[model samples]
Target: MTKEANAAYDSSWTFIFAWLLLGISLLISGVRDLYDPAASAWTTWLGFISSAVFLLMAVNGMRLRRRRRESAEPAGAAS
Candidate 1:
């Protein structure tokens, strides 16, 4: 990959990883709530919001990766 492509790839993975981390954090929160059984309403709403944000980020990252690959196809085939 050229420098620009490499930078794009890295940024795409960064978004994916950030969302993944949020998901894992939410999972951990769920587990804690399960063990304690004293979770608050705020906690529940926060979890839902986090999930929505993660989904959005994941979809955006996927779109970005798809665009990058599709754009590279012609250049790759020509070479």
Candidate 2:
């Protein structure tokens, strides 16, 4: 791949990684808050849901990107 294409690929993965990290952090925080007596029930559930959304986004992004790359590859070379 050309340098530009390689860079873009790396950047896309980086973005996905960032989202994954964000989701993990949110999930951890939500779990932690779940055990805290002072934590609000609504906010904890919100954080949990938000984390699920971010994680889903990251996974979907990775799947879509991989599909695109595979489709762009030559049929024989795809092996």
- Candidate achieving the largest lDDT: 1
The superposed Cα distance between candidate 1 and the true structure at residue 22, in angstroms, equals: 0.4
Tens-digit lDDT track of model 2 for 1-79: 9854664566577667666665665676667676884665656566566656655665666677677778888999956
lDDT string, candidate 1, 1-79, tens digits: 8855665666667667657766776776778777775764456667667766666665676677677777878765856
Q: Residue 69 of candidate 2: its Cα lDDT?
A: 79
TM-score of 2: 0.54
Local lDDT at 58 for model 2: 56
